[model samples]
Target chain A: MSDFTRDEIHRLALLARLEFTDEQADAFAQQLTQILHYVETLNGLDTTGVEPTSHALALHSVMRDDEPRPSLSNAEALANAPEQEAGCFRVPPIIQEL
Target chain B: MTDAPAYATLKELQRSLEAGECSSRELTQALLDRIEALDGKLGAFLRVTPDEALQQADAADAARRQGRRSPLLGIPLGLKDILCTRGVATTCASRILRDFIPPYDATAVARLRQAGAVFLGKLNMDEFAMGSSCEFSAWQPTRNPWDPTRIPGGSSGGSAAAVAAGFCPATLGTDTGGSIRQPAALCGVVGLKPTYGRVSRYGLIAFASSLDQIGPFARTVEDCALLLNAIAAQDPLDSTSAPVATSDYTECLGREIRGLRVGLPREYFIDGMEPAVEAAVRRAVADLAAQGAEIVEISLPHTEYAVAVYYICATAEASSNLARYDGAHYGYRAAGTRNIIEMYSRSRTEGFGEEVKRRIMLGTYVLSAGFYDAYYSKALKVRTLITRDFAEAFRQVDVIATPTTPGVAFRIGEKLDDPLQMYLSDIFTISANLAGIPGLSLPCGFTAEGLPIGLQLLAPAFEEARLLQVAHAYEQSHDWWRRRPELA
Candidate 1:
């Protein structure tokens, strides 16, 4: 079984974008190990020649015609925006000067 | 003239409305009154639009007077806040969208309204439907009606609790992993996650597009079937919705289960399962067998991988879907950001919960350039195997039966310290989502501690009619639904 080390756990948390305490990291490492152990049982199954199914029901070409249809107007769309200006959603600048 | 019509199912309420025994306005007011009395403790509703509900109800009553009758006419139910309700708050139990009222109704919500179903309000859920327990909601956690100190299983926790508490006849809930079934199991209600594509998801806030399915939580299997009839149809708005023919789910109720094959997967009866829960499941199976249903042991060997595979696949999809949540769109925005990129980062950081953020990160990692094949692709391969496991098992038996949850409801905060432990609560239910099969959880027995236990029955995709029939048959043979939570 692959052991999830503190570094690996930290990497996962980082990827998840969660700022976790050291204690939480350690705790999660132990917990994730147990979960992984249970999940590892999947290794025993032989999936030879089995077609990998993406959805339960098979669907082919699930697309609609490219006809322009009536949709919520921009006014209705931006009406719920917490901040809006010039018919577009307004947000603070992303680049930090600090 | 009688008091509140508590314990009435949706069909019963509809009959009353059509017979003019009660009007939609009266029923809506009754539900609002119940919510006012019980929601102080249950915390099920995220928003209560009494005036809007009454207005719709009055219109429904007028329609019935004109001889227009839909099965759900005038029935009051809650929409999971995750479903967009036009001109109504659909916060999805997250701070990011707390103040956002959608300008468009979800296809499911719009259809429910067209069916003459009255909306009681939007129910609470795990923030972005990420958590197993309702504890992740930005709002207060919804309490289990059976025991206020315990959690109402989530991310459909509020939907389950509201039905269990009789605040509404039924409620709509979206299930990605085990959100619908787990909570329904824990809350002792009938919760069914129909085969994927059975219902449309045009306006449901996307979690995992492929895995997410909207279904019903009700007090009985019959009620669930009725709700499904009203909601399950091929929707032009939802490209992924099934184009198959729909069935009237209640038609097979009370039918003989005699000589029916029921498979008990050995993989599901693993170690660490609570003995009481196992006993309850066995007892229910024995009862079915005594009723002439054939009980056979089967193996879904790949079932063990569901949680890992689900986490990988669902998170990957969520990471992609939620990428659109940048402040440029509706939802929360961070102040003092210098550019669009930083705005997206800060807004997401502040908008999502710890669990959601964790999954998003995991999703990002798995979908990242280097790890996509190793994690995401491999998970999809394993998911295919999981579905095949059910497929092969179903060939041996008509339906698969198991304990809905590994154990009865755990006390709130019991596993909050260990997120992994909390994740395991969905272990038994996740495989169903992985396979995109129709699965139902209904009250079967009670633990020695007096808490309810549920039995899960699963069928191949698009077999909701059979699944509901099996559940309804069992419900008829048992009196578990007659018991109510001792909450005052």
Candidate 2:
């Protein structure tokens, strides 16, 4: 991969749902490039036939009874909601009105 | 009880409470008072709920009077802020979730509560457990008790500091990438990270699901074992929690370590590592060899690639986990946004710290359509090699010994400027997390500058008992843990 350019960082900030200042974007371009450059040290090894390990443990699917159980109460679930209204999380309109 | 400063190992305190020399209420109040006086200088606690702690303490005392007993009964302990406590604010030291409270307890906290542990309240960490130092904490940076100008090694810096400062006998700290051990090493306490899935992560605000494990920081190895006994168990709530049977962790204490093979990896002794830290770890290895254990020089050939793998995996996981914090559902929300997308962007940019944004963006970049194969996928292949290296070494060794950190704790602002340097500093401790094995850090020695050096011990999966046993043996022969900062 090439060095991280500021425009690429800007695009990434949007993809990640974050907005960075011009200074932060530029700084990130440099810092992220450095971090990725160091991360490139892994390229020295030949892992041609090696399987990629996503999890170290050999985890199997867990099963449970299909019995009904009490989950969190509605009020409890909404307790930390930053914008709750009418027993639901209220949010700004996704579609702007003309 | 003797008229001493509030520094009693959990076992000693348990014996005192059992003997009826002092009531739980009195002991809890004394520790609260000590925290009141001392914790101002060391910001180990994010919140100190004396009233709630007293109520719990009274209940424990009543249970004791009624003939109830457990090892953790009436013992005051701190929780790392990352663990959710019912009605107690559980921020993972992030500004985004500063006002967040859980409606239920984390399984680990619940187990400890059932074992009659009193909550001394939450400890601080790096914002979302991201940074190497607690300086990334949204609230306050936890200062080292040994030298106030230096940082307490983090992201469980507060948990380590609280135990080392005698604010509490022990505290639970989560280690995804040496959060527990590095700080425990710097703060001069014993810290343990059990094998992945050994403890339930149901209510731990997840940083990385596959890597995070809740463990302990304590003044003694025995206290850590007692704590592990109370909390280490499978849970129906956390699917990732292994159904493997747990044993009495304390059973292995005081057991002879004769003929045990301990591996010393040459890669851990790098060129730029602090000489004192290396010396301390070598001295510990020599001490173990003197006690009839065979010391072998082993090769974990892929050791150099640990930090690279960890950053790729951990950041990728973190970016996904943190996606739930958009303005609509919970956590901080931005005001005056024209539409939802802008709201999400504004809320996240404002709510997150620089390190967090860097990681999220970096993670996004790696997982993006063009870069996955080059970065994330490549890192996973290297991860296999790292795990294989440990698996190969453990075949001939019972435990592996290494320095917990490359150096002693740095001055608070020293490495904060360079993100890459901060990430590289975790080189010694990140491998254990990557390999899903057990690792522990105990005070081995001190430097001329009076900073504590940590000696880390690694064991194969589910071999926490071995690490505790070996650490206990080393701890018994030395007085390193006996020394504390002159807090008075």
Measured by DockQ, the strongest candidate is: 2
Docking quality level of the chain pair in candidate 2: high
Residue-by-residue lDDT tens digits, candidate 2, B140-243: 99999999999998899999999888888999999999999999999999999999999999999988888999999999999999999999999999998988
- How high is the CA lDDT of each candidate model? 0.85, 0.91
Worst 10 residues of 1 chain B by lDDT: B1-10
lDDT of 1 at B431: 90
What is the per-residue lDDT of model 2 for residues A22-98, given as tens digits with 9 covering 90 to 100? 88889999999999888898888788998999997999888899999999889988998888889998888888769
User: What are the runs in model 2 whose C-alpha is more than 4 Å off?
Assistant: B1-5
C-alpha RMSD over true interface residues, each candidate? 2.8, 0.9
lDDT of 2: 0.91
What TM-score does chain A of each model score against the native chain A? 0.74, 0.92
* CAPRI-style class, candidate 1: acceptable
Q: Look at candidate 1 and tell me the lDDT of residue A70.
A: 88
* Candidate 2 clashing pairs, residues 3+ apart or interchain: none
